[model samples]
Target: MLPVFTTPPPLGSGDEIAVVAPSRPIEESKLQRACDRLRETFSLDPVIFETATKDWEWLRDNPEARAEDIMRAFEDPAVRGVVAVTGGDDQLRVLKHLDPDRLTSSPTRFYGFSDNDNLRLFLWKHGIVSYGAVLHPTVTVDPELHPYTERYLRRAFFEESLGVVEPSPEWADEWFDFETGDPREWRENDGRTWRGEETVTGRVWGGCFSIVKWHLQTERYLPDPGDLDGAVLALETSEDVPLPREVRYTLRAMGERGLLGRFSGVVVGRPQTHSPGLEWNPGDDYREQLRDEICAALDEYNPDATAVFDVEFGHCSPIAPLPLGAKVTLDPTVRRIRFQ
Candidate 1:
């Protein structure tokens, strides 16, 4: 097993946080609102890069520029944390330009999800901790940040462990229209319930499924048995909402790479709401097929490890913040996930 490492302390009040756009560009207005909310609500001073608000013409206008912003954020001692504006599909193109030494030496709170999975695992491989959770635009635009999201963000970025993560009292649907600026209505759906009351604690790792699968093809964040040993594997799919066979193939590939059996447990997020082109109805059996594929993969690979499902951590509303590389304990009996 790769030796475990410690993360730096959370950003206290009055610390500076840098906001950057590492992948696709974003809408300037929404980005500014996100920054403004952070300052007004949390008293955090933010530093934003130029490209963060500008939508690059391509995957990224310049991968080197993205790398520079990240490096600068890490190198700046005043910057206590870093948050991505949003995530996009192609971040692997920028991996080669990053300076791992800077990321390793200055450990800041790195927050993002979806395609940011590419960067999160990169940080993890270098012994730095990053977070897999809501980013600025997604969480900031909420009429009010979801209580669970705010609660966990506070714990992950400021305070210590507040307590366990329970299923969101209310959840959201696939129809949230970002352009309208209205808070998305909460929609609860049925799925698997927490199985048992046993808390399985271990190091936390893993990220978005499609992105992780993409990373596997490159050296930037390929899974290593040594790095994954004893870590808790966490995953969620993206908006693409891949089919069951695709999901199975991806997990099966991980198993082939010897990554499936190395973790202490598995935490799977709820499947995303709007999958492109697949107009699956609310009560369709697509999710059931997904569950079956996942179970098959797990049983084929690591049947002994503890596993749980129906976690509200994906391209869903009212998401929970998860600190990557931190310690997480899953209690199926009580339906709680505690990060310590």
Candidate 2:
């Protein structure tokens, strides 16, 4: 049997949440603005950890300190939850220094994604459920938080269950330079569509696809393949915006390792097609190509598993918070997902 991870308690008004830099160092100005927003909007106190605003050189050199900040936040009695300043490229370096026992013993609510997926999966390996969406520098720093993002964030933090998952009426693929004061932008969302079997339910697993690939390379952090049996694999590409062929190659690698066939279902987040170097916006056709490529890979590896596409998570704006290690019901017939 897979070990049952304990769900951390929900947050409430007046609670203190620690802000830590488990990946890249945070900008002092951005951190202050986010902290102020947290205080004003949620009536909660934001306690910034020392490492959150440390110099990039110090942060890069001291992976142990980053690991320690996470440990201390979980161990701290005053902290009700923990949130990351932002996600970065090298969080895997911090994993070797973390104590699994300490994390399991305290199991505090953690919110982050992208590179922080390392910590999310680490918490999962230790039987602790953690939230996987939104970060201080990204979603929280917005002049006005998207209503869809705010709604799900509230449910993930304050409520016992996220009753239903739905796509936002609109979404944003373009990232702004918050440091340089670029204005936020959004485009109309047509809606989400699914493929594969009509319905399937299982415990959730997965994070940023690139990070998961990194975990496989290290041969650490991931749970045994047996532990993931019958899981609903949730995957999303990052800002790097890997090509369709690259995505297929990565999934094919997982299939070769006997990982793909173990899951009963798959939920892939909407692909971020456009980035700084990419000339064209990733419009409908590009998304369709991504879906086809992913489905083709899944067909070759895990034909029996159901799959859903364009989920409102990962590198997209107004993403939903998925609790790692929790059960979720995916119904393609009705095009609905409900978190238990």
Candidate 3:
């Protein structure tokens, strides 16, 4: 059995939430709007750092500074949670500078996805609970944010148990054209449907597959021998929408490392359809290929593992906010996910 760790304390309406650029540099204007939305819509204070809006030499150019911001958030008695403005390509660079001892003791509610997977997995290893979910502008800042997205974030941060993880009726990969300063584009989004039935329950973990593969190669965010046993592993590809083979290869590596068998169940997020160079058909064929590849890998490691694919979460609209270390009860009987 995995040694369950501590769950971070919840946030209150008037409490402050820290915003930091742990991975990539977000546009100043975009960051401002996201902060504004958080305050106006959510009614929570959005605290930002000096470099929160700047793009310097690298996304994580100032590793020490980035680490400092995280430590500060965890140490601050007033700050209820910490959120990453956006995800960049290389966040593993910031891992070495982090004070794990400080994080292990603090257990602040942290949120981010994509490359932020580096930080999420790091927190998991140190016995601190973190969130693997959408960020500010990615899922929040828009003409109108997804109702369920806002609700999930609110409950994940402030409420005791994230009551029920429901299938988002609507989902999307559309980016709110923030260059216009107008929030009119927010309503554009794809919708979600309930996929295969039969929910399974376990602790939640995992994130962007690319980032997790990167961390595994670097041996940075590995869980202790028994830290992840019986956990419900959740994963999603980034905007890149990697080929089915690439996904299989990554999972194959996990099996080779003996990590794939640690999970009691698995939750696969619906892949994003749009990308810069590649275009994938949002059809049943593509979905079938994806399912075949992922299942092939899992079957090789743990054939009896409970798996659910195409869950409405990840780098998209109407995404689900998952607490990295939270216990998740996936009841397929009702197609529900309850976090306790």
How many clashing residue pairs appear in each of the predictions shown? Answer: 4, 0, 9
TM-score of 1: 0.91
Measured with C-alpha atoms, the lDDT of residue 312 in candidate 1 is 68
Q: Sort the predicted structures by lDDT, highest score first.
A: 2, 3, 1
User: Which of the predicted structures, 1 or 3, would earn the higher lDDT when compared with the native?
Assistant: 3
- lDDT (0 to 1) per candidate: 0.73, 0.83, 0.74
Better of 1 and 2 by lDDT: 2
* TM-score winner: 2
Query: For model 2, what is the error of residue 60's alpha carbon versus the real structure, in angstroms, after optimal superposition?
Result: 0.6
Model 2, stretches more than 4 Å misplaced? Answer: 177-183, 278-284
TM-scores for all candidates: the values are 0.91, 0.95, 0.89
lDDT tens per residue, model 3, 1-340: 3444777888888789888888777667667778777788778898886557557574445887888788888888888898998887888888888988788767788888888878888887766677765355554456677688878877877777677777776555555665664643233223323333445567777888888778777874677647777878888877787788888998898888788888878888877666666666545355567778888997798676777777766775667676777788766566566788
RMSD, candidate 1, Å? 2.4
Question: How many residue pairs in model 1 have overlapping backbones?
Answer: 4
Error of 1 at 106 (Å): 1.1
Residue pairs clashing, model 1: 196-332, 196-333, 197-333, 198-333
1-340: candidate 1 lDDT, tens digit per residue? 4545657668888789888888876677667777776787677888886657566774365888888888888889899988888888778877888988887777777878887777888787777777765355455656776677777677767865535777777766555456776877676656445433446787777778877777776654664667777778887777777777788888898888788888778888877655547665424665677777887887888776677776767576667766677788887666667877
Candidate numbers, best TM-score first, in rank order:
2, 1, 3
